[model samples]
Target chain A: MSDALPGSLVGPVEIVGAGLIGTSIALACRRAGLEVLLTDSSDDHLRTASGLGAGRATTPDDRPQLVVVAVPPDHLGAQIARALAGGAVVTDVGSVKVGPLAAVAGVPGVERYVGGHPMAGSERSGPLAASSALFDGRPWAVTPHPGSTPEAVALVEALALLCGAVPVRLTPDEHDLAVARTSHLPHLLAALAAGALADAPADHLALSGQGVRDVTRVAAGDPALYGQIVAANAHAVGALLTGVRERLDAVIEALAGGDRAGVEAVLSEGVSGTRAIPGKHGGPTRPTGTVFVAVPDHPGELARLFADAGASEVNIEDVRIDHDPGRPVGLVELTVDEDRAEHLLTSLESKGWVTHR
Target chain B: MSDALPGSLVGPVEIVGAGLIGTSIALACRRAGLEVLLTDSSDDHLRTASGLGAGRATTPDDRPQLVVVAVPPDHLGAQIARALAGGAVVTDVGSVKVGPLAAVAGVPGVERYVGGHPMAGSERSGPLAASSALFDGRPWAVTPHPGSTPEAVALVEALALLCGAVPVRLTPDEHDLAVARTSHLPHLLAALAAGALADAPADHLALSGQGVRDVTRVAAGDPALYGQIVAANAHAVGALLTGVRERLDAVIEALAGGDRAGVEAVLSEGVSGTRAIPGKHGGPTRPTGTVFVAVPDHPGELARLFADAGASEVNIEDVRIDHDPGRPVGLVELTVDEDRAEHLLTSLESKGWVTHR
Candidate 1:
């Protein structure tokens, strides 16, 4: 439990909507040795969640210390309001915070309500995809509205910690704006970039490489679900999109007029932006070097290469495999600390691997 | 050598630059048992290429049968013109073919000139990054103009084969347009998206996820170099950017008007675009499934995981690792043929490894 809370959570925790998030939370709470009551509009989902040992069915006799509402955006306000009517400290796991917070602002016992958004998810949905470890080491935004009580906010933060996530406190508006900049805007850009390829000729498509693939990877997500998410944060996303439009116009004019300096300025800003992202472990970014090695494509080849790489005792920060369509060999790029790159390269070369830094 | 050519290249290939591409071509030619003569304006680069055994220094007495111009875009025209003066079957490895082809159009013996662009590269430049396997199984676009002789085009195609690249024939203008749609446009979009993050608050950036990281990866490339590449194909790229801008405006308008259907239409188009990309082996895309496993953040953990995975005898298509910053565990996603996913999951679980499909 968070120290800011007056006391530890001893529950009967009620979780509404036994979907991916709800079931996962139920599993986590059960793992923490708390009693959990689960419910969902879908009987099949509720049955599956219970069968997976997430929790038992809720009853009118049960009095929960905490109520977690994890449902779709359209039903969130109603579900949260209904949960709060049970006179329990309540929180809802929704991507956007302000709308839901506004929905229940005038409800009775509004001070008991808080908003949270877990920074973890998958392309697949439903209770079948739920895991107790889903939120392990992820960021869970604890968004408190002006009407939220201090104890309610602390309890929400404690729930985040109980699920093995780090709780980041913010006002509801700030959380919405932050996710709008980081998540919604990037997704919109990916979709826009990928949409250009829809009508391209086959010859043009043949020229595709890793760059286009990376930029459009996330655009393969479900359209309706993403539409709901983006629409919910329209105010923040619209502002960012407008700013991007201005930059796009600038680039268009620059290219039209052969203004090389203008193009470079935009590219240079991108470089700085990449640098601004925090590195692994939520720390400052560190300089890294890449070593490329050719690996034969087979069942055990990657295992052998990884074993050999492991023998060198270098911590690989990241790995990328570039498969050659016309050959049996794939190029594997391993990223490591800059200072130790030379050592890893020499070690791999000594082991008869064809490596290049 | 391509059968389209009259005969195979015997010896005495002249390379007009000692940079990454030139030296790599030189090494590939040498590996094929041909004599390579290398030259560069910088004596240091020439000495280094020679010392690395990529090729020997060029001399006036060396009468080469082929000349490969691999200089920067600024010097490509002059060098290709100079190479043609030696009365050899001439080709230049540059990204944009139309510009260089136009530069040498008026030169005498223009029938001997062909344009080639191998779709393989690295961020690092210079002779030190040269490798014989750099072009292995990659596409090499052979752009022949109206005046190019059959023998000259065939010889250029043979050069592509010698470097282990698949030759795809197209007109010079078509090649430019292809790359403009596939490569240049995606790069510009990535830069535009990343540029928006340059002035963002640190708090906002802390909410970053893998989606943002993948989308912005290529935006970290050298600004000046990318500026030149994009500028060279500005006509095609500009047209694509205009299309993208219209779509962006539509999305903004859709959001402002609360039109969820409009937003979803754009996203649905992006989904279709991703589906249109050719799968591995340049074949039709096949259905694939991913199995997720928890891995400890240690040196040999990957080796052990891969070794275990190989025991199932299922071919892995791709791998992605999602590291949890606050924990020692990283989630590794292994993509494989869809039908094999269940077998792999069962096998991994039997081996006492926790896995999910």
Candidate 2:
């Protein structure tokens, strides 16, 4: 009962599923001081999500102010229709908006339903991994059909705002193409990279680096959901793959002939052009702020080593410990203040701490 | 000049072609208190390198103990042959070792030649960009053929040591495959990603994000240089591309009609498989430290802003600036000592610093 957040701000949200996305939406809504009702086909998932404090389960006597339909693209229209018929201002969260919108458009009083998708997620799946802050400061698209009411659109926008998401306006086709380039294409590329190494000897793969990990990060996404998503939007994805294939073909041709100039030109183009792409939250993706350190082994040594950092009031945003068991040392990635990094290293070394430059 | 780095090291060296690699090698050699005779086809290039204290120009009278052939891949074999004819122990710093090694293998008295490719570089080209620290702590692969003199191999490794670079022995084929997977394929991928926007209007391209920029960063490399490298390693690169294409096809198919379980399984495989990849210095890459700061557009802001971090007594390692020109504020990426970051940010904010969740 934080009065600072109004009734409109504190949602009466009913999530129709308790899978990853559904649980995440519930978690986020609850965090914002909302009353969330979560229902799902799987009672086990509901229990898990509930244990995570996503929201308290509710009965039908509580009329939801907004209903978010989080289900498979195939089953999405039905869920939205059910929410609307159940007398709730409804929205559906699905990858492809057009198909579901088209299917449900003929439904009487379709304006009660608005289409939305939060374009931020992780490879982690299931209700067990639902995050209350998953929707924080990310893009959320709302697709409203011609018959959609202004109140419906406004309500959807309010949900996005409350969830700390940026609202983007686009036609169904525009949204499709944009995601095809950004979201869907990256997933395809990552999957392709991952699939190539599926059968590789484990030892060879251990030698892989950040580049491959980065290129294939998205490949870890849920294939079934992705399949259902891509099928609904095959034309856009197919077109993108065709472009990738053409470029790859040109690269192959240049390599076959040992044409140094041709190969370099293509590579150069990629470097220059990619710079223009914005980073998350519409920021330039600038590279900075990482110091890789190699350290020596000793059970109590790491704890003591970090003590100095603790004394200094530094915060490590991320850490990676890569140590071969037999080796007497390890490599640690310490994300720290760039300006103070040189001084920290100097101080650490002065304290008899070993470091990899 | 500083005395020798207290390590048992070798002497007067000759470096051919004072480009980025050659000049950088010269600088490293000179830093180790070894006299180096640097040669290049362009006197201007040689002078620039010499100005950077890389090395002095060589005279015919200089019979160097070690000779480094830092020419283009296509020109390396001929150059190594000439250097060997001069009775100098030689090595070529070319991206493709097998091709050049084959081209010069039968040259008279070829035992003195060792083939090398330093697996580290930047997109920028030219001798002016050379730095002694360029190869420090990076991998430098040395491929000594059967006929290579043991002394030559040792000398090449000694050079790598002087540059503070680790010496990795890769068979020509292993080396080819590694570069193709880690370096070449990434370039192609990045290029294709970047080039996709080539057809996009400039304004639309301006909205590119971090993911796209990251995937495309390597695309800005020199086209001519890449062409030579790719042409030389056609088979390896071609195989990698084919692998990429197959994987991509699978992803597309899965996304089109696959279920959530299927897609998530595929994505999970990628994360687990890729997390095993080693980082640049042979460790896994991790998220660097991070600090979220609310920065406003004000005069003398950055300096005063970071001054608050002084309380934590930790130096910054890297900095990222994210600003929206239209907005009055921005977010700064401050990477610092991991342990100190939390206390520092807290102290900074307590001093009236602007920050947000």
- For candidate 1, the per-residue lDDT at B292 reads 83
Off by over 4 Å in 1: A1-7, B1-7
What is the lDDT, from 0 to 100, of the residue B99 in candidate 2? 85
- Restricting to chain A, the TM-score for each candidate equals 0.96, 0.81
What is candidate 1's lDDT per residue for B179-227, written digit by digit as tens? 8877887787888778888888877777777788888889999999889
Cα lDDT tens digits, model 2, A1-357, are 123332254567899888778888887788778888988888898889889888767676877878899888889888888778777678877887888887787776687887888765544467875666555555678877777777778888888777666677666666677666766666656555565565554334443444555565455555666766766777787788787787777777777776566667677666656655654336555443433454554333444555655455554433444332223454455545556555655666677664422
**Alpha-carbon DockQ of candidate 1:** 0.68
Query: Model 1 — TM-score against the truth?
Result: 0.96
Q: Give the whole-model CA lDDT for all candidates, comma-separated.
A: 0.85, 0.67
- Give model 2's docking category: incorrect
TM-score per candidate, in order? 0.96, 0.76
- Which RMSD does model 1 reach against the true structure? 2.3
**Model-by-model DockQ, in order:** 0.68, 0.20
Tell me the deviation in Å of residue B308 in model 1.
1.2
